[model samples]
Target: MPVNRRITLAARPVGHPQESDFALDEVDVSSPEAGEVLVRVLWTSVDPYQRGRMSEAKSYAPSLQVGDVITAQSVGHVVESNDRRFSVGDLAVGQLGWQEYATARAGTVRPVPEELDPQTLALHAVGMTGLTAYFGLFDVGKPRAGDTVVVSCAAGAVGQIAGQLAKIAGCRAVGIAGGPEKARDLIELYGYDAAIDYKNDGVAEALRGERVDVYFDNVGGEISQAVHRRLNLGARIVICGQVSQYNAERPELSFHPGLLIMFRARMEGFLVFDYAHRYDEAARKLAHWVASGKIRWREHVTDGLENAPRAFIGMLNGENRGKALVKVAERAE
Candidate 1:
């Protein structure tokens, strides 16, 4: 039997998370029961949303209690299987948390398609992150050809994909990121027409004279307010993850109802889980785009399962360039 090490919440984070907030523990690895499979986790994702779960504040999902395993989207090899759907060597991806080994019912994990080169892509692009960008932009933002689409956190996981998707839609994509390097990557790597470095160049100054038709806002703060002032008539704002406010103990309140009224704009918030039934539909299109070189992504991976906490903290602090993942094991034994 292999050692099963997991990262658990040692304390509820007050503001930005600290390494002391997490604890490492070794648990007994359980064997697969009927209709279940034991997975050897290879890659586990560390996303911004997990920050909300670390706090006691109420939100979309139940908060994580102290001592609970940090929730993560993981891709792993099925080492032991009791279900007919999965074999001992098959690969699967799902909410397997931050652990080296996990035992889940067969239905909880979807088998990775053989064609997907480097199965770790299942943790981000063409998975939940890509789906978030797809639904939020097309369904909520409703971008049209020739529209100026603006995305916040453009160098991050969902932001990069959204920017590319906007380009694919024949819209002019503008991305806002924290630093100059990230801003450069937005245009050179992610296909954004223009990039705004919010840290150096003010959002209002950078967006001057630009009529934003679609605002895919991932960071809601002063930056969003600046974009609101530039909304074109009937502009749409898709409220995705609020990376800026995720770690705040008391989130700042700000609103622009007057701007919405004047521009006749619409602001909507959506959860990727709401579109769960149509996942395969989105996946097919995203896979096609990725295969055709229409979409590209990068990963900022941390080595070792014990570093999952540090990786999660880094992601929340905007230290990661693209998708943040923790490598648990190289491969299944």
Candidate 2:
């Protein structure tokens, strides 16, 4: 029998996840049933939202139960199959947990193109990060030419793409991030017109009297309030993720309702699952931009599955430069 190693949630975290929250165990790989395939995971994505899942909080998805494998989006290769739709060597992307092997239903996995770079495609510019940026900027925010678009968490996976997309749409892109180096990278590397280091400067003052037409908010809390204060008339705010407050022991600060009433600006929150039907459309456009050198994608990859918890915690602490990923296993040739 083939044995698989898996990381399971040992306890619900009160705030941030610790190493003890997870436990590793070896188990026999059960054969794929009639419509399932056994996948050997290659890479797994560690996103900010997963932090929410660690607690027994109400969310879009259910919280991780004790003893259950920690769930995540992973890209892997099919090593054995009972489903005719998938072949033994096909690479696939799906919601597989942090495991060396997973038996998944056929419908849940999407085959990845052999020509695509699995490392890059699995996380940024071509996957959920790209899709999040595309829909948040174009669909929700609807940035116009000459408009000033501000994105929080600017050096992050979704923020980098969203800022570049704003520039591509002929909008003035302003990114807000932590630290001096990330602020510089946002402008120099990702084509952002300007960047504000929230840790050092006051965000509202840094706006320099410019009215923001669109705010793509990835890190909520005080930053969201600051952006709300500078919103122009009829501006749109797209709420993507709230990484800044993810580790807070208590609920973090929020904006005043009066700001919304006074500015007449609209704020909308969306999940990427809402646009699942249009992923192909977003992927094609993002790929075209990437190929033309119009957009740049960045990733901070950790080399081992055992390091996923550490990487995830560090990401929330602003340790990662871009999308955080764990290389679980090597892709089969």
Candidate 3:
């Protein structure tokens, strides 16, 4: 049996996750039983949403208990299979957590499309992140052509794709991110019409006297409040990940009720998993956009599974440019 290394939640984090909150453990891998497959994880995603799971808080998803393997989406290849749906050496993606090996029933994991090169993309664009942006923007945000769509945390994995999708819908894309370099990437790389560096350039000042038709809010707090004040009539606000509030023990109170009434804006929060039946619809479109160069993506990959804690911490601190991932093992050659 192979020794499987995994990261487990050691303690609930205070404000921000510390390295001590996670523990690395090694265990013997177990073979798959009937209707299951054993996978050697290649790429693991470290998203801001994972921060919410680290704490015992009421959330859309259940909080992770102490000693549980940190929740994550992973891309891997099946090494052994007891299910006809999957065969040895097939690529798969699922909520496989932070581990070198994982066992799952075939129904729980999806086969990776063979055209998706660098299989790591299954954990980033053309995968969950892309689907999140696709459903959140199109289904919830309901952006219209010629509208101005503003996205917070604009340089993040979902944020980057959301901004581009907004542009593809013929909306004027505006992005708000921290740091000058990220702001530049929002415009030059992600193709946002305008980029605001909230850390340096004031968000309110940059967006002053502007009318926002849609807001794809990724980080909620004062930044969202600033955008709220400038909403155009009948604006739509898609409540995506609230990265800024994830670390807080108590929710950061903001968002005046009057803004919604004044703007007649629709604010909706959705989970990508809720659209499971339509995942193939979104994936096919995202894959086409990516292949045709309509969408661009980047990955900030931390080298080893042992460094997952560091990568998660860095990602929470806005240190990563795009999708933050842990490269657990090399892809089978």
Which window of ten consecutive residues has the lowest lDDT sum in model 2? 114-123
Scored by Cα lDDT, where does model 3 land? 0.92
C-alpha TM-scores of all predictions: 0.97, 0.96, 0.98
Top-TM-score candidate index: 3
Q: What residue pairs are clashing in model 1? A: none
Query: 1-333, model 1: which lDDT tens digit per residue?
Result: 887999999999878889999999998997999999999999999998898888878789999999999998999999999999999889999999998899999998988897997777787788889999999999999989999999999999999999999999999999999988898899888889999999999899889979999999999988888998899999999999788888776777545688888999898999999998898899889988998999999999899988988888888878998899898888745
Model 2 global lDDT (CA atoms, 0 to 1): 0.87
- Summarize candidate 2's per-residue lDDT along 42-63 as a digit string, tens digits: 9888888888888776789888
Task: Between candidates 1 and 2, name the one with more favorable TM-score.
Answer: 1
Number of the candidate with higher TM-score, 1 or 3 = 3
Report clash pairs, candidate 2: none
TM-score of 1: 0.97
> In terms of lDDT, which candidate is strongest?
3
Candidate 2 vs candidate 3, TM-score winner? 3
